[model samples]
Target: MFVSVGVRFEANVEALNMVETAGNYSKHRRVPYIIEEKNVLKIIYVPAVSGESLAHAFQELLAEEAISEKQKVCRKCLRGEFLKSMDEENAAEKFDGGKLPSDAEKLEEGIVKNCTVEDIGGFLYAGKPPVKRTSAFQVSYALPIKKIAIYSTVEPQLHARHAVMTEAGKKTGGEREGAAEQMIYYVETGTAIYGFTFNLDLRAIGLSAITGKPIIPEDELRARRRAAVKSLARMLSSTQFGAKLSRFLPLGGIVSLAVSVTEKPFTLTSPIYEGFEDMTLKRLEKIAKEFNEQYQYYVLGRNGLETPEHVMTQLIQYLKERNTL
Candidate 1:
């Protein structure tokens, strides 16, 4: 089974993913988006979040969920450092000082067996005859919805830090020895309706990418798949997978969401475009008829639509009925 999700959300005064800082001014990540206006093409820079950021958050949540279910997770991944088997030394850490298999296939099997996060998230070992496992899941950068992207804005908000004056500073004419009594900074906050896509290949979990075989037992495979789905549902419902949430949590929930499940791989129309929900429904119908494959879809913006949790719950039920979960 393959699952694809497209999301459109509103974020207000959010600094969820900042890229750089220059002289007390931090900047939000931005990317160029092209659009056509009056028979002319134009490019606009808009605030965005990197796919790396989204992937990291997903893996972190996966680790947490896996551990809670008594599934194996590597030490580094458990601590949220996803330096997945970068080299021999790093791969060995998952084995607790045991010798790592020299054969690439054996190494991949061992790592998949030992770490649910690595199995789902993939890894590349830059060792002799390097081995690579592609991630079963894919995420796209969070970009502003194209229709209203021109109105999206990133503005600097001023903040200040004040320190108590010391007696020595008072004696030195209100000047601290090596520090200022007060400091001012600016945080670039963004407001927009952002869209992103996430896809998970359920067939890839607990399967050996190197040898085209199963690496773990069926029970564990089901557990890992469930963990992956639950992690995504939780992340979207809570909107808790970005930076600076303590102070700059976005003041919005999901504006719309669409999810598709297929027997074969299929991607939904991107939610950044207008009328994506209808487009996705039509495309799914065409693919089902053309390919003669079973598929299911749910959209949250439609009439009488349920919450994200409910939508995911329905998906889990569907997968369970098909014995895919």
Candidate 2:
């Protein structure tokens, strides 16, 4: 049962950076590319966002949630436990290789025989191995419908240190506080629609082979999918990424989850909204009708538009019915 989601978000000074340092001109934030489509020599800057940013934001939120709630993460391997076991294994090896047949040798033998010790000094220590699990959640680059403008401004800040000219001044280098300036860039207000999808196919990932665990139980997979959906709903609401970017909150957006009733794997994405007004039940209905005859949708926001309350209610009901919640 795979599901596709379409997202439309309103930006009030929302900025997705191309590089880390937005203040530096060399590393100023950019969508992706600036190009021209023409027979004549011309150039155009295309404003776009990266899917990596979206994935990172969600992943950071998940890590924080796991830490705060004391919940175990299912998507990644337990690095802490693995590290501790490796440390013990290393200590045992050191002791076993010593001159005397000591108690550490017996301990080493026990550890070597332990079921948890899968591949010692093999793929674990050598090169970077590929990801084990396929991420069911995905996000596309957010490209604005209309042309966007970028504004650059320099702000002053106080610095705690300063440079001296002479060697004598350098020797007496004390706190010479001074004010510094830096330039910041921001994208002009515009709406960008980001496409999303969630593939529920488990067998394709080969989870059992990667994690050395049995096939993920139905209940667990359902729980993971539910969490992923909840995280998507909270993408704008949660400000773990930054309060400034998603500051104004999502004015309105449409998220549809089309679950296949049959055993076959299927996915369906809603049409990308060119503008906020485009997010409507009619658009969602078209996607649902085209993708799967049997499916459910959750429409959010009542910003001067006709929005049914039962959409959310029905979403919850369907989740409960599917034993996902």
Q: Which runs of model 2 end up more than 4 angstroms from their true locations?
A: 18-28, 31-43, 64-71, 74-132, 146-214, 239-293, 301-314
Model 1 C-alpha lDDT per residue in residues 1-325, reported as the tens digit of each score? 9999999899999998999999899999999998778889999999999899999999999999898777999899999999988887778866657778778888888889889999999999898668899999999999999899999999999999888887777788776542575898999999999999999999999999977889888988999998999899878877878899999988988888989999888889999999998999999999888989888998884545678777777778888898887
lDDT for each residue of candidate 2 in 188-285, tens digit (9 for 90 to 100): 33334333333333232213334344334555444444544444445544433322354334334433222222223444433333333234344445
Model 2 earns a TM-score of: 0.51
lDDT of each: 0.89, 0.38
> Candidate 2: deviation at residue 37, Å?
10
- Weakest 10 consecutive residues of candidate 1 by summed lDDT: 172-181
